[model samples]
Target chain A: MISGDPLSRVLYIDLSRRKYWVEDRRDLFEKYLGGTGVAIELLKEECPKGADPLGPENPIIFAIGPLNGVFPLASKTVAMFKSPHTGNLGESHAGGRSAIAIRMAGYGAIVIKGASDIPVYLSIYNDKVYFRDASALWGIRSSHTVGRIIREREGEAGYRTIMRIGRAGEKLVTFANVVTETYRHFGRLGLGAVFGSKKLKAIVISGKRTLKVSNAKAYREIYDEIYKMAVKTPAMRKYHDLGTPANVVPLNNLGALPTKNLTQARFERYENISGEKLAERFLGRRLACAHCPVGCIHLAALREPYEKEPYFYKTTMISYDYEPIYSLGSMLGIGNPEGMLKLMDVVEIYGLDAMSTGVILAWTTEAYLKGYISEKETMGLKFRWGDCETYLKAVRLIVEQPNDFYGALAKGVEYASSIYGGREFALAYGGNEMPGYHTGPAAHAGFLTGSRHSHLDSAGYSLDEQAYVKKEELTPEKVADYRNTYSTRYNKGGIHKKSSREIRQLT
Target chain B: MVKRIAVLDVDKCTGCQSCVFACTRRYGEAGVGKSAIFVRSLGGVERGFIVIVCRACKDPPCAKVCPTGALKPRRGGGVILNSEKCIGCGMCVEACPLGAIFWDEENNKPVVCTHCGYCVNYCPHEVLGLEEVSTG
Candidate 1:
């Protein structure tokens, strides 16, 4: 690390006292090298053992790496907290202006602690931090409206990130999420519920500081080399053209896509929601995180007319990706693109984790069909597969929590099935909803053992696919051995050639 | 012959900030504080973007407002900065209507685009280009 690099500074904000300060943590940055490594250490230091996930003792930490803002494609911000849903380690990564904004704000990591007495939002402009009352903005119907309002109130139009929750968070839904830039999210393991418990409505961060490199000539050469590879690489073209949704058809064709709560491994109507179809029909725009040349975020444009007035129309831009399409589309048996987009819009508006919400709904639908749950529990609503309107209403009910059934649904499928007698098909591992992969046993094993219970953790699905290509069987011993070797190699600071080739194939 | 950077298509910009960083990288830095060019969203990114840079006015207002004559008019348009003569008054920053005259807070000096066209190479979408202009 370069001397005088702002990456060594850590910002600490205590909402209980409305106080803030900055500390130079060169020791931590030097040892950990930032991002998840630094964040986990901070979480261990600040969070007391056995503290309640939703309590004040549980700290929310946001960290960015040294490569952020200085290099391309190193654009993710890692958020670490004790998950209210899983009661364990909660880690999520989001790509947007977040990592760049925090880096330019002159901090490598931000630790938010204690609980506010009243609803409030924090406005962090460079070194200054302001805690503004947000009581008026609480309980807003749509998270989109919250973002729009914050955008108007804040400055730094291009160099800021607004992260906020919606009614689901305010209501303390355990699977709720924190939305950033309207299209990106800290979307797993209930970060939003923790924010709700702390009475935190939102956080806006911006900065315009210059970062200097130790060796200017080497920096320029390396940057240009990476830029050329990013733009000219044939693999990157798929991401720019159709975004991650490109994986839908491939995964579905391989009989690896989890459909209808894992009862089916492939969807017959997968083509309707495939990347090619979505891009051709509704790709309204493509976006990228700051400093990343590859613009992989794709938004779909859905136009509809007023209920009674046919001529009056409005268009809504909803973002789509492989995971969301699998969870909210195939997993729920929704074949109509418009219907899936509409359902996705509702989930986004409420700031719920789409995967958990969809899985919980799938469980509830199956439970209803099996007579384990009834119309009385659902408030006289049906939970049939492919019924977008009913699912939309059910999603609202989950946040609203009108009854015990809806309340259980809000806790995630793991807890919901435990209560509703459908644990056999709950489709969750390690208290987190299953990701879109049903590739093989390794995927399930990875979900159970991965620190975050996320597929991105160990990428077991990729391993499973690689095994299939090589005509090999993936036993538990092999998976464990592979994980050990992979972690050991990563700890040594270099991924071997074979691992890199496997990664390229997976991508 | 003189050349200046032009905005080929504002809508083609993905708000990646690649060009902005490219501007600063030309000076051997890694941040945007010293960049002469900027790309801001139009209200929100959902709509589009507005790229702000020195458009090379034939009679530039920024140069006229310099108190110490630190800014000299270039042959084609815009102005060149002599840092030794600059008193860091920041009048050039305020005089520019487009807010393209960016101030380097660290150096306490104004940074202006020299129409170098270095950022044009980094724009993957061809949203920016360099073209010969008649400054009559």
Candidate 2:
């Protein structure tokens, strides 16, 4: 780390006391670096063993890497907490102006501890921190509205990042997410529920501080090299043109696209919802995270006529990716592009983790088919595949949680299926809903053994694809060996092997 | 011929801030504090962005308000800042209608664009370009 770099400063905010302080911990920054490395250490230091995830003891830590504002594509902000969903280590990465805003605010990490007695939002501008009352902003119907209202109320327009939750988060839904920059998110493991538990409605941060580099000439030369490569690369062009939805057609062709609760690994109507189709028909805009030359975030414009006024129509710009398409489109058997996007819009409005919510819904649909659950438990709505209207209503009920069934559903698929007698087909690993992958044993092993139980943990799906191309059989021992190799290669000589006892606990 | 950076299409900007960083890099730095060019969103990014820079106004408002005569009109249009003579009163920052004069908080001096067109090379979307105009 550079001497006098603001990356060594850690800002600690205690909502319980409405007090905040800054600590210069060059020791931790030097050893752990930043982002996940520093965040995990901070979590270990502040969060006590056996701490309740939704309680005041489970601290919320947000950290950014040293290269965040200094370099392009180092745009992610790592969030660490004890998850309300899994009751275990929670880590999610989000891209937007989040990392840049946090870094420019002159801190590498922010630790939010304790709970507020009343609803409040934290406003952080450079070194100043204010706990503003959010009484009027509470219980908002749409998360987008919350972002818009905060955007109007906040001082900085482009420089700030507003991270807030919607009704699902306020209701403490176990899979609720924190929406950042209106579209990006800490989208998994219930970070928003932790915020809800703390009565933290939102956090608005911005700064205009200048960052320093040790060597200016070398920095400019390397920056230009990277900038040139990013703009000229074909891979980046694909991302800018079609985004992650480009994976849909190929995954479906490979028979790795999980459909209808993973009962099948191929969707028959995949072409209708593929990236090419979406770009041709509905691509409205493309966005990029701060400092990134490649603008990959794709938004689809959905224009529909108002019911009362036939001639009047409203257009909505909703962002989409491969995971959401798999979860809400193929996995739910909803092939209609409009319907899939509408369902996605609802999930965004409520600020729920789309993958978890889709998997949970798939479990319920299967459970209904198996006669384990009935329409009575569903509160008069039938659980059927591709019925967007019914699924929309069910999502609302899950947030509302009017009955025991909805309450169970609000917890997660793991908990819901355990109580509802569908454990065999629950499709969750480590108490978290499965991501959009069913490639081979490596992907499954990665999910079962990965620290976060996420596909991004080790990218086992990429390994599965490699093996598929080579026509090689994948065994459990082979996966374990590959995982070790992956860890040693990428994790700076650290070898990771899960113990049998730990595996049992995770499963 | 005098060359000035022009915003080709504001809608093409993704609010990436690459140009902002590039402006700073031109001075052998890596932050936006000294950058004369800024891309701020109109309320939110969803609506689009407004690129604010010295449009090379022939008679710049910022230069007219300089108490220390630190700001001299450039040949192209915008004003050039002489940091040695600058009193750092920040009068020029409030004088511009476009708010293009960025403050260097650390140095306590105004950062005004010299119409060098260094940042135009970094705009990936072709949102910015350098245009040659007659110095009438």
Residue-wise C-alpha lDDT for candidate 1, range A1-507, written one tens digit per residue: 988899989999999999999999999999999999999999999999999998999999999989998988888899999999999999988988899999988999999999998999999999999999999999899998998899999988888988999999999999899998888899999999999999999999999878889889999999988999989876477678877787777677667878888789989889999999999999988777788999888889999889998799999989998888988999988999999999999999999999898888888888998998999999999888789999999999999999998998889888888887989999888889988877787778878888888776777776676676566788888888886523333311112235334544654
* TM-score to true structure, per model: 0.95, 0.95
| Candidate 2 local distance difference test against the native | 0.87
In model 1, pairs of residues that clash are none
Encode model 2's per-residue lDDT on B1-136: one tens digit a residue: 8889899999889889898888888777666778888887777566667899888899998889999999988886888899999999999999999988998888999888888888898898999999996788
Residue A497 lDDT in candidate 2: 18
| Candidate 1 Cα deviation (angstroms), residue B42 | 1.9
Q: Model 1 misses residue A297 by how many Å? A: 0.3
Clashing pairs in 2: none
**For candidate 2, what is the TM-score?**
0.95
Every candidate's lDDT? 0.88, 0.87
Which whole-number lDDT from 0 to 100 does residue B80 have in model 1? Answer: 96
